[model samples]
Structure formats: C-alpha cells, structure tokens
Target: MVASSTSSRSIAVLNTAPTQPSAVETFIGNLLELVIHSIEGVRGRLVGGSPQR
Candidate 1:
C-alpha cells in the first residue's frame, strides 16, 4: 500500500508603512532574500547528490 500527505501554503502581506516606497522596498528585499536562500539550499542538495525532499 502507498500513502501520501497533503499540505497548504499562503503568502500574506501585512505591512502598514506610511510610505509606499519604503513598503515596496522592504517587500522586495525580503523576496530577494527568500529567493537567494532557496536557491542556495537547492544547490547544496544537488552538490551533495541528495534527493530533494
């Protein structure tokens, strides 16, 4: 027999910055950081020849 699991995801933007420019900058910085980290993690896994979870 085979079993599987399911999960849900979400992305909420909760910012109350008075300035639009600052809020956008903050969001962009966070997004970029997230992408960079994710890429690094994937690269590490590939280099180690480990199957991605």
Candidate 2:
C-alpha cells in the first residue's frame, strides 16, 4: 500500500511539472510577439512607408 501511494504521488508530480513550463513558455511567446509588433510599428513610422515583408 505504501509503495502504491508513493508511485501515485510521483505520477501526480510528473504530470504537474510539465504544466508550469508550458505556462511560462506561453507567456514568453506572447511577450516576444508584443515586442516584435512594437518594434515593427516604430520601424514603420520611422521609414514613413508600409512595413517590410
């Protein structure tokens, strides 16, 4: 019974460990996208032309 409980707890931990990194990765991805867009907007205004392809 003890072994069974221990294994179950480990399994739960393993399952939850992946979720934190995924959330962090998602947040970083969104932040990078926002930064890229802001940079593009600034570049567009400076060039006074449409954004580059």
Candidate 3:
C-alpha cells in the first residue's frame, strides 16, 4: 500500500511505495509544514534553545 506523510521540510513516504501525493495534498502539506516549523522556531527562540525532554 502507498502511504504519505508530511515532515518539517517536505512530503515523505512512510514505506517503499512508489506512489506520490496529489497536488492539493502537496500544497496543503507544504503550508502546514511551514506553519509547524514557524511555531517550533518561535518557541525555540523564546525558550532559549533548550531541548525539551
């Protein structure tokens, strides 16, 4: 089966499936990733670079 997931940088396959995500999924995923990364970056900056447990 083909499975797709979104990471902080780009879309990734969960397994060795050759299938790709649709254009809409890709576009929305990119926007979601950007928002996630932005939140993480802002949190890091405010938290003084300390790694969370």
Best by lDDT: 2
TM-score of model number 2: 0.59
lDDT of 2 by residue, 1-53 (tens): 46998778757766879667567668889999889988998899898988754
Best by TM-score: 2
lDDT of each: 0.61, 0.80, 0.64
The TM-scores, one per candidate, come to: 0.56, 0.59, 0.52
Between 2 and 3, whose lDDT is larger? Answer: 2
Which residue ranges in model 3 land beyond 4 Å of their true spot? Answer: 1-21, 50-53
At residue 16, give the lDDT of candidate 1.
Answer: 37
lDDT of 3: 0.64
Off by over 4 Å in 1: 1-18, 49-53
Task: Write down the worst ten-residue block by lDDT for model 2.
Answer: 18-27
Q: Can you rank all candidates by lDDT, best first?
A: 2, 3, 1
Tens-digit lDDT track for model 1 on 20-48?
65676789899998888788889978799
Which ten-residue region of model 1 has the weakest summed lDDT? 5-14
Candidate 1: TM-score?
A: 0.56
Candidate 1: global Cα-lDDT?
A: 0.61
